[model samples]
Target: MKKLLVIGLLTLFITPFAHAQFGVKGGLNVAELTGRDGESASYKAFYHVGVFYQAHLLGPLSIQPEVQYSLQGGNLKSAFTNYDSQLHYLTVPILAKLTVGPVFVEGGPQFGVLLNADQSGNMQVGLAEDGTPAYGNVSRPATGSFKRGDFSLVGGAGLKLASNFSLGARLVAGLNDINDVQNLSGINDPRLQNRVYQVYAAFQFGGGK
Candidate 1:
């Protein structure tokens, strides 16, 4: 069912290609993990790059669908260790846009497939002879414990400076728990979700009026 939905959306996005405007976008992402038990998480800065197609539906309204490759995740400090998790995803967002003058607002549903997940950090190994704590770098694959799919909502507002240039900011909030770890002890675990803030610039090519 989910796979079918994804395929349908992809088909819809490309079906109007000849009449749509093509654009490229790249941005910075401030990402973090939400709903962690008692542990606090910090934001991790990452980036996203994508291409999109926009088609006018009516006066002041348009549909924009995008394909993006994003790097996300968060940082955590637990006990004597610091951890940074890197999550790589391929995402699709189907947005409905409203334009007024040079300003526009958009909101949409986004679907993502996780490509990889990894954690790299430093852990306190022992105490030095001088009584200072010693640390060692550690790295591990985290993909096995996380869900393969991510569902989210995207919302933003932006300004079009010209026919081919624009700037925007967006917020993407995860709509589903992305943790897939199994607890054999029958204890409920905290749900993990993705949260991100983005600022980007877009450049468009000729298409619609």
Candidate 2:
């Protein structure tokens, strides 16, 4: 169903703007979490790489479609626990771009399919008499606990750089819950949505009609 939607929309957007340009990009990702209760997850380091198409819809406006492999996650620390989880995703974004010569701004919706999720950290049950975690290390497998699909709103602006090379940045905020973690075992929470700030550079190769 989602796949069909993606294909159908891409065709609709691409067909009208047949004179599109193809490009490749890669960049840094600063990611964090929001919405979950009691979770003070901080921004973590990650990366994203992808390819995109820019189709001119009008004189100064265009429609862009992108496919990306994004590595996104967060760093979480509590009094008795600390860990970092790495999430891998295949993301597709369809953006409406407004261009003014060398400068442009684009905003759109993105859909992500989860590829994998892994966690590395230490967990503890209770503090020792000295006020330290009794069980120092615990492994939490984030698999099967997180949703397989994610949805986000993305917006950004950039320099077109002579129509060949470009530099840009964007923010992506999760609209759907990535993880609804709650347990009778005092385990998880529902506010594990993804938030990422991405800065990238792209090189244009092929020009479309």
Q: Which lDDT tens digits does candidate 1 get at residues 1-209? A: 99999999998776655457999999999999877664568999999999998987767888999999999999866565577889999999999989999999999999999999998887444568986767688888889767999999999999999988999999999989988866412122448899999999999998434
Question: In candidate 1, which residue pairs get closer than 3 Å at backbone N, Cα or C atoms, i.e. clash?
Answer: none
| Model 2, C-alpha of 142: deviation from truth (Å) | 2.1
Best by TM-score: 2
Regions more than 4 Å wrong, model 1: 1-19, 122-137, 183-188, 207-209
lDDT string for model 2 (26-105, tens) is 99999987665554689998999999988887788888999999999888776556878888999999999998878889
Q: What is the lDDT for 156 in model 2?
A: 97
Q: Which ten residues in a row have the lowest lDDT in candidate 2?
A: 180-189
- Please report, as a residue range, the 10-residue window in candidate 1 with the lowest summed lDDT: 181-190
lDDT on C-alpha atoms for all candidate structures = 0.86, 0.82
TM-score of each: 0.81, 0.82
